[model samples]
Target: MGLFQPDTDIFCHRDALREDYQPDEIVGRDEELQQYIAALQPVINGDQPANVFLYGKAGVGKTACTRYLLSELKSDAVEYGVDLTTIRTNCEDLSTSYQVAIQLINDLRGSENRLKPTGYPRRQVNEWLWDELDSIGGTIIIVFDEVDHIEDDSILYQIPRARANGNLKEAKVGIIGISNDFKFRESLSSKVQSSLCEKELQFPAYNANELRTILRQRADTAFYEDVVPREVIAKCAAFGARDAGDARQSLDLLMEAGDIAVEQDADQVTEAHVDEARAALERSRIVDGVAGLTQQGHLVLYALVMLHEEGKTPTRARAIQDRYKIVCDRAAVDSLVPRRMRDHLNELAMLGIASRVERNKGEVGGRYYEYSLDTNPDLLLEALDETVDMVGVTESIRKRRS
Candidate 1:
């Protein structure tokens, strides 16, 4: 027998289950799709395209639906004999307006006339962007996905008003800004907000039944026939619904379960495989979450974990700060003050690794917040132990337990 079994392969096209995979047809987003198509209909009618904004929680169909419709729009534009140029850039990696402009310029001008990322004033960058758009000489739709990542709102204002401001003589520019941050629009200057928020659409989270349908469709393409059972898909969808109604999470769980089944030389993915995959995914998330923190962040979380193990949870910020100092000493690092430690605690809470609740101690005592670990303390300790040299930290915890 060979080292591996030829018949054990489960996946037909694994990429279909990936987060970035664009399906031929989007399921469970008809309302949102129609709204989006209405926003772009002006482009088809040879009118100025409206600036559209899409906002929602992550793992919803924001980016996917945008891409799917844009592709269709491009095809339709050709049949209408309209000159349409669509340029898409993910703003997550481009923080400043200048950076985004340089990217757009390079994308439109091609590599030969590309500008460097730096060494140019903001005005020059804007000029270069307008120049590129004018050269294209048609209705241009520029999409900035993860638009919240850009620190400067100047570009947001400049692009949407390019035509009215006489910046683009030939090309009419429309912007499609996509963000997971709900407060991103409010943070924008009033001027930029007016332009970009002309047509706003919100993508709600996918319900369990919706996720099930989506998973079934993707499963047909991603896995071979009869490899994934109906119950397995349902379980994955339920887990995703419980978490955040995230389709990406459900698909990831399904794909991971299939991989686990293959690894065990199993013939099909079952409920047990899905459970194991969920556990593996949870552990991976905990480890990756812990690893992404700053050194002080790690120490603070370790402190919280240690305190929780001692039944000292639901503790106050001052208590956490004191324990955090001991943790810092054990790790031979300087400790932050209580106020700064509170900030770290808040950051941890934001990451869902910890949570805070407020209580009142009557009129005299006023109100204060108590913090506790939101995740499994043992799993967190395991992740921290793997991520850093927690030998002294773990020993200190053992001493306290004794």
Candidate 2:
């Protein structure tokens, strides 16, 4: 009768689907795993490690596979009597080479000896890093997950060539750069590229079958027997495959469905639960995406949504500009110019909240672009209501939805 009573019906080991939970086996990435193992083979042989770069879309098992393989490599290295050390830090917050150097030094020094965020010269930071690396005096692998987030390539250039540059005498260091941006490699300077791209691997998206295999494994582990049906698994897999080909998305769908079933006091998860979960997730995504926009961005999106509701899109920026000005005035903010308005529209298209199409009118007229909402009208209106005062537009959209 307690409000927070535990429910044993749906999830047995829910942490199985948690982000930090590392699976013992990596499914749907056999080919990539073999190549990755080959790249790490030098570690076991007590040779200088290769600087490996892995590029792929998000949730394609790049980091998960790395963790799985590195765990095994660590085990094997111990048995083989290799002096190996692995340290990982996400680059999402560390922007400059100075920040990265500070982070690496702090990581090597442990939490009790952590460095302050500021008040250090760049050269001194690099020297401290080299000093720490030399102190370790063995093969060390430093992994920069989301490596593209770092603004400068100075660290990328230095780490791989630290020995040749006489920065370190004892320790042999290697870098593992994991990024979701495929173009990040091309953006690197030629010097940095030659060093970091010595060994590169691409992780492709998982198909429906592969997602099914992965979800089935987690479902079996996380839920009691027969709590998750094969049909529900297939539906989740298909939805994930069709949307982003992300294993994480499939797992999220399964987990959300289970939570919904438990909330409803049902005995088992069903396809209807998955459908409800998908709708809820889509709405959450829209809300989150909309929440990140600037005030002007919210105005622009509201204008586009109004146009979409009126069947005026995929219209041109000129049309959206007119409505946008009105929205800006209503919100008591100045409107942006046509060009700046188009920039927001393009950003919306990039975020998948809106769709853009380009048309050419032969050599005389040049090319023009049209824009429209790619998201659900009802959802966008609801999201906009939370961010901006679009009462007139909101009432219109909700009226149609009803």
Model 2 earns a TM-score of 0.92
Candidate 1 clash pair list: none
Give lDDT tens digits, candidate 2, residues 320-361. 999999888877788888999999999898788998999998
**89-144, model 1: which lDDT tens digit per residue?**
99989998888889998988776877877998778788888888898888999999
Highest-TM-score candidate: 2
Candidate 2 Cα errors over 4 Å, as ranges: 312-323, 337-343, 346-351, 355-371, 396-402
User: Using lDDT as the measure, which candidate wins?
Assistant: 2
**Cα RMSD, each candidate:** 2.8, 2.6
> Candidate 2 at residue 68, lDDT?
94
The lowest-lDDT stretch of 10 consecutive residues in candidate 1 is 389-398
TM-score of each: 0.91, 0.92
Q: Per the 3 Å backbone cut-off, how many clashing residue pairs does candidate 1 have?
A: 0
Residue 303 local lDDT, model 1: 85
lDDT of 1: 0.89
